[model samples]
Target chain A: MRHRARRKVNQFILHCILLLGGALMVAPFVWMVLSSFKPSLEVISINFSFFPRRWTLANYIRVFREVSLGRAYINSLLVASCVTLSVLFSATAAGYLFSKLRFRGRDQLFILTLASVMIPPHIVLVPLYTLMNRLQWINTYQGLMFPFLMSAFGIFLMRQFIRGIPNDLVEAARIDGASDFRIYWSVILPLVRSALAVLGILTFLWNYDEFLWPLVVVHDNRMMTIPLILGHFTQAEAKFPGESMAACTLVVVPVLVVYAFFQTQFVKGISMTGLKG
Target chain B: MVAKRRVFNTYIILVASIVFIYYVLVCVWPFAFNLYLSFRKTDLLTEDKFIGLGNFRFLWKDPIFWRSLRNNIFYLAMMVPLGIVTSLFAAALIYRTSGIMRKVYTALYFAPVVTSMAAASLIWQLLYYPKIGLFARILSSLFRLDPNSLTFLQNPTTALLCIIIMDVWKDSGLRTVIFLAGMDEIPDSIFESARIEGASEWRQFFSLTVPLLRPQLIFVGAIYSINAIRLFVPVYMMTGNPPGGPANSTKVLAIQMYQEAFYGLRFGYGATISMVIFALLVGLVILELRSFEQRWEY
Candidate 1:
């Protein structure tokens, strides 16, 4: 009985430690949200407040009113959605082949795909820009979305997931006289829905936050993504820190909402990707 | 089985072609062009000149290139191990805890990962303010430190270090989750046996966990190294895009490449620098992956 009580006390201490750590980890974000609401002068004031003195929606209103934030938001949403859909389409089709098919040179081709991941995007940045320019894609949606539409990581992830499915199920589908594409769409796709979800969310998040490629490829402000737009304001470093803060908040909020909704799966996928790599 | 094999062969070939073309265009073709570009001299308005590796010769002699390369190494040195240690510590603590607390802690650690790079960069910009930001105010209050006069970003000596510090904080959480997942996978039976043998927690951790988690450690290390080397956003934000502030103290290789490609409009020279970065990353990745494969005995 005494030992049980001791164990309970130990568990309580551990829980308390975890809760405190969690709060400390989350404090910056909490601070960001609070600071966004605080008046601009109060934001940089040495006398910081955990809670704001005067809570207002002024910053957000300013974001929409002052900057071209709405257009950037729409651009980010459109590009991210397109990238996610296309990555899914390509990766799923390839994954199905790699796992279920036995074509010649499949292993050689898969190795080739894997090799590309090691070549950092920066290495290809210049050449890709040149290519995009030649295609008259510079400062266009196609320039922003085309190269990223097929991701090595997404393909790798889907391949791993598909590899785990039983061979018998695929054989059963074939025995039923289903066409290969039909089996892929109706059968394989449903089987790997979880992987697709993981890939989609991950791709969406990455494309939404992508800055460098877009910065290089798209010079047109009218076509700017949120990160690129927010980047311009921050880079300008004008006296109006309020509007920049507003823009930053505008860029952050939607992703946070998506994260909140799909926190578990997204995190699981991210964590898994890290371990796998 | 024969029919299935025939069907599989056709499908695999079809898939292979698409993936092959993608790899060729996105990965191989551009890389070849990057190499080709590096050897030539080209401005945006002029025709590219084939100088047979003139850019390499110039880069080898360029003072700024060498300085930026050194600064990049310094940044990586500070960022990588600090990030690894902090993350491992956080992961260990979380692993020691239970249920609801675990979920809460995980999400908190992951918040920065979910946040956009631009947004995080801006937040850190404010946080590093010499007079009004949290770091400065704390220093001033506690030790009478003259934090009000110092602007880390504007000062060349402090700019790179400041960015390194922020990168560690933002990136450590993701590393922690990766380490935590690896730690969770270690069989409890092994630890239990160690405990039964009268091993202390520290001894058990150092003796068993560290060695057993080699593959995970290598994976995290390699990925972080690659990502850290590609550091662009914070530098772009903090140092006003040219990076290397206060007479070019913080200018890393990637920033230099960006300047060459986009700002200077020396497309060929920019491509050359990009290729150098590519070669370095590829070498490191190959070494790490080989070791990871060898260590992954399970």
Candidate 2:
């Protein structure tokens, strides 16, 4: 009875600590969304409240009118979708070759590609930006999508996932006179649908949040993605706390809503990023 | 038949080479070009003039470059161990628990990582709004000091620390999840045996669990160090009005590189700064890849 009581106390302590940390982890996001809905004055009022004293869409309306928030949103959607599709294609095709096909210097080529993940865009942005300038691609959709067209992590994840499919399936398809392209299209693609989903979701989230590249290449407001447009809040932070909150909410809520629907896959994809070989 | 197979094999190889060709264009070529640009003088509008080590010599004396480099080092120093160890501890605790509770805790922790970092930083900026913000309100009452005087982000001494703390919040979830997955790979039987030996829970963890988690810890360290060195969005978003301001306290390698290259139009000088990051990252990536390959053997 004494041991059981001690165990119960320890468990309770653990619960208290984890729950406290969990609240801290979740509070800012909740605060942002709630505070955005609050009347502009209430957000920065001396008496702080978690919920809106009187909810309003004034902040959102103000932001959309002053800043090109809607255009930025559409730009984000376009760039993210295009980049995600391109990354998926690049990753899946490379993954198929790395896992399923044999070619000269294949392993070395893969290691080279994988190394690209470590090479942050900042390092390459100058030269690439200059090149884009020469090509007259700056502030264009092509410019925004160019640097992000390939993802090394996507390739690596797809390779790891694709490696698990039984070789007999590929060979059997070959015996049935299904061409290599057909095997990849039918057999490998179907088998790796879950991996593709994970990569797609992850790719979309990452590309949408990408700030530095967009900030550099996009000199015009019309070309701005969500992050580049968030630069608006910085202009007069002290004057408009509610506007900043609303912009943040606009940037964050959709991603969270999507994550809510695909929480398990997002978790698996995120956790696997480090742990997967 | 063999000739036909050769043709088919070429088609497959051609398909795979698409990424390779694009990789060369986007990644490889620019890396080489950046290196070359580091040694030359041009903003791409002017005629490219070769100037050997001119950029580096200037960067060597540039106090801001040193400051940027120092800040990047400080970021690596503070963020890495705090992120890794705390996440490891958090993961270990979560691992001990069971069922729906585990999923809920993880999802909540990971919520920030999925949310837009730009947005997250903005939210944090509000929370640091000296007078009416949460930090000021709490710290004021607890310490019996004026909340108006806090000025956390504006105060140069505290700015970098604030960003690093917020980063720890944003990122610890990722590290924790990674560590959680690593812990899952560790067999319960191993702990069971340790328990049978009358080992304390702490002893079992310190002895068996920690040592086994060495690769994950190192991998997370190297990976995040590369990330922290290239820190931009958080610093930019958090520090308002001429970012890296209030004495340029929060300026990091990537921010410096951006300002120099894009705004200042000192293309060669900017490339030199960025090349520093590239070299540092390559070393970290090598370290990460070493552990990464070792993970397969494990």
lDDT of each: 0.79, 0.84
Candidate 1 pairs with clashing backbones = B244-B251
Off by over 4 Å in 2: A47-51, B1-10, B290-298
Q: Pick by lDDT: which candidate is best?
A: 2
Candidate 1: which docking quality band? medium
Model 1 B-chain TM: 0.92
Summarize candidate 1's per-residue lDDT along A120-233 as a digit string, tens digits: 565689888888989999988988997888888878888888888887888788888887788788888999887788778788988898888998898887899988887776
Q: After superposition, how far is residue A30 of candidate 2 from its true place, in Å?
A: 2.5
Error of 1 at A256 (Å): 2.1
**Residue A15: error of model 2 in Å?**
1.6
Residue B261 alpha-carbon offset, candidate 2, angstroms: 1.0
For model 2 the local lDDT of residue A80 reads 96
Pairs of residues at least 3 apart in sequence or in different chains that clash in candidate 2: none
Kindly report which residue stretches of model 1 are placed more than 4 angstroms away from their true locations once superposed: A1-17, A45-51, B1-14, B296-298
